[model samples]
Target: MKRNLLILITAAALLISGCATGPTVTRTASDEVIDLSGRWNDTDSRLTAEAMVSSMLSGGWLERFSTDEGRPPVVIVGSVRNKSSEHIDAETFIKDIERELINSGRVTFVAAGAARDELRDEREDQQSNATQSTAAALAAETGADYMMQGVITSQTDAIQGKRATLYKVDMELIGLENNQKVWIDTKEIKKLVEQKKNSW
Candidate 1:
């Protein structure tokens, strides 16, 4: 009974100390602020966005828009192939590019098949007695002129008890009407970490 009482007292004291100190808040070692770190598999999405932006400008996509009588180009987020070992949300990257392009006022976003369905439904409801017809009804709904698609790949290498990770993201925009690829983009990002030794 005495030993049990002493053990309970020790446990209580340790718990009190732990509560007072609280848990440590670990911070990333590198000075560079990156997207959420850890073994997340969504790295390709970010890389894809970066590559598309660079390629769009370098591939003269904006020039094409200007040549088309200043009519903003329409883009649709298409399938982004995740060929990596892990699954990732590629739509997030597509959405990011779409958001940026729309905000730039140089491009217009064409709703995807799902969005088109909802838009048509809304237009039908308003067609009965509306003060004004929607833009969708006024003109032939222009389908997306360009579709964005991509693939993600990865590689792992180890040396001197350390491991390095490499990620390659490739994307392209193809003209829908003419079946010609208008833009091609690629981005690569890598990270390395050393293995930790066990403490004695």
Candidate 2:
């Protein structure tokens, strides 16, 4: 019947309209600061790295090490543990610090952790595949004079659609030879987020 066809067509149109389409995405600059969820993000990582680098390079540790060693102190970036509630990629923060240190020319950096394993594997591969002249010598890699390690912790409080988070990042530089802690620093970031209750 004509009435049945009309109902069927109306239902199909409503179902099609209710279906969700693809997401809308907008590109932004890499360095531009943006916070959507009030959680940790690239801006936080970048700012923390900048603050840490500034504090570390301006401290007396680098000078004392260079004075005693007669060369820039070699550094290896160790683990940066994330102890926060939310999942965070600590590698990005660690890489940022390493990049700054290398660019500053204040210290030399050597690979650590998995990266060291990869480098060693490549050296082993070269032992048999390449000529002696072109192959890198084993046990000739520079040893780190110091190790940099740190942890990131966070606390959150929420009540009545309002929430606040505090993040603390603690870092230290330790001498590999004597196990002396040369430098220590902490950076803190706080954010507040609020939501409104539906009035409908």
Candidate 3:
């Protein structure tokens, strides 16, 4: 009984100390560069997508397609396979790429995956619930001329208390009609993380 009582008292004291000296939390600007883990993060995803899409827009494929079709090519963001060892959210990356593509005004963006399915479901629902003029017509959806897909891969090297990580993202634009790879670009981010000795 005495040992159990001592253990309980010790645990309570540790918990109270933890609560008393807990870490600080504060809100900062969203775009602020904070690398707590030196892993793949939102900043990396957004910046990489912006750079790659900018390069893709300047590719010869865009000019070729424009000359042949006389319109901005309708593009869709396809899957970005995450083959990295670390758990990374690919949807956030995809959205980042889509935003850059749409904002650039160099291509027509089409809905894909869940968003596309929801749109179709709404269209079908409107057929019965909405007036004829208000209902979105069927077969009016724009087909994507090119599909952009990619893969995110990473490598890590560690020795003693030092570690280095390299992440690569490769994206390709493929002609939907012919399965031809029209453009490809790669972006890389490298970080060296050092574990500091406990100051206390």
Candidate 4:
């Protein structure tokens, strides 16, 4: 009986001590400070955009637009071919170009294939309903004067557990009416990563 009472008393004391200890608070590195030491996504995007802009300006596309006697340039983004092994969002890259072009206030963007298809279908349906006299007037018709397209290629080389990744993105703005190339740009990004073997 005495031993049972002592055990119970010890258990109660331990429980009380544990309760008084309260919840543990762990301290680690603050997430607010972003660590970009190894990551090059932001840098790569900026560099790619800058390179694209430089390529366009130096290629005389801007100069042509300014001097050539024609209507305002309306560029439509066409297919962006991805030749890389890994799946990538090519539309994001095209959108980046579109955004920069819009922000620059130099060019106009016509709806791409997807948007144009939807709009065409909508117009056809409206015309069938006969609510409007002509679909031409009912729909805003804007054919793309220039088509923007690109291709992304990737290369990998590994030796002795060290790997290198190279991505080359090339884009061009072609005159749709005359099939003439007006603007061309290419951006190359290379990265090296060391591989570590797992010991199990």
Candidate 5:
């Protein structure tokens, strides 16, 4: 009976202590650089997209396509495969790439993937449900002249609580009509983290 009472007292004390020092929450700015776990993060994605797309736009393909096609080339983001072991969100990276492409003003950006299909569905619904003047015409979608696709790869090494990881983002822009690779670029980011000696 005495031992059972002691266990109950100890459990209650521990629970109370835990509640007294519970975790705190604080909000931070979106652009703040906070690397808590040394994983593939937003900063890496944004930087990679900015550098790679800038270089891609400056390539000879842009001038050649503009001259041959007599207009700014339309581009669409295809797929950004995350081959890294980490569970990185590829869509976020793809958005970053699309943003850079659109903001550059050097190329015409077109929608791709399911979003394109969603637009088509909406157009079809409009044609059936709305007036001819209000409905958007079918088969008017502008096809992309070039498609960008790529993969993300990573390597990690650790020794004595010290860990370093290197991520490589390789991307390529290909001519949609010819399936020819017009521009290819690779950007790399490395991070190092050390585990605290007293994990407790």
Candidate 6:
């Protein structure tokens, strides 16, 4: 009788342990689109970058600048302010845009903000320790003719188990020397999620 009781308890403990374990995890491709939380995601960033860059390149801004200067215009990516309800990493989106811009070869991109500061620090370090010819010169950094800035805003609505979210990203290009607004654009994304409530 005691042996049977011990066997029953062991089985029950094993079952409870199995139940307490969390859900399984599986690795997927980085580019695969997966929407588990209905929040802004990698797919949204990539799509926005592609759309914005495509529009910017095909528009009159590049041609006009190249016509006037006879060379590709230099551009710097500035702060992309996130005024959304959820915490969003703006750098990932900005880097995506920068990558597309650089790959296009129509615009020259220069490091800005923290990246520029880090580069300057590295140069300073090299000036002290590295060989003279290998050390980079100060004040020789490329100047950006245009600065890109933007803001992201979001709205969310929920009713029972249904939820909807809308995200809007607005961007602008300004001439650094003349302080003129040269180009502006906006991209938007919407998501709908339906969840079932536990009835127990």
Which candidate model has the greater TM-score, 1 or 2? 2
As a TM-score, model 5 comes out at 0.87
Best by TM-score: 2
| Whole-model lDDT values for every prediction | 0.69, 0.92, 0.94, 0.72, 0.92, 0.91
Decreasing TM-score order of the candidates: 2, 3, 6, 5, 4, 1
Worst 10 residues of 2 by lDDT: 191-200
Model 5's alpha-carbon lDDT is 0.92
lDDT of 6 by residue, 10-83 (tens): 99999999889687999999889998888998999899989888877887888999999999999999999999
Instruction: Name the top lDDT candidate.
Output: 3
Candidate 2, backbone clash total:
0
Show model 2 residue runs off by greater than 4 Å: 1-20, 198-200
For residues 139-184, could you state the per-residue lDDT of candidate 4 as single tens digits?
5687777888888888877777676778888988899989999878
TM-score of 1: 0.68
Local accuracy of candidate 1 as per-residue lDDT tens digits, 1-200: 99999999999999998879666887764434454432333444544565567567556776866697567677887776777655566667667666656666667778775677887887777776565644336446777778877787777776765666787778788889897888887788786756566211
TM-score of each: 0.68, 0.88, 0.87, 0.69, 0.87, 0.87
Give the per-residue lDDT of model 3 (tens digit) for 1-200: 99999999999999998879666899999989889988999899889999999999999999988999999999999999999989999999999999999999989999999999999999999999999999999889999999999999999988777889999999999999999999998999999988876211
List where candidate 5 sits over 4 angstroms from the true fold.
Answer: 1-22, 198-200
Residues 29-103 of candidate 5 have per-residue lDDT tens digits of 988887898899898888899999999988999999899889999999999999997899999999999999999
Clashing pairs in 2: none
RMSD of each: 5.4, 3.4, 4.8, 7.1, 4.2, 3.2
* Cα shift from native, residue 100, model 1 (Å): 2.2
Clashes of each: 0, 0, 0, 0, 0, 0
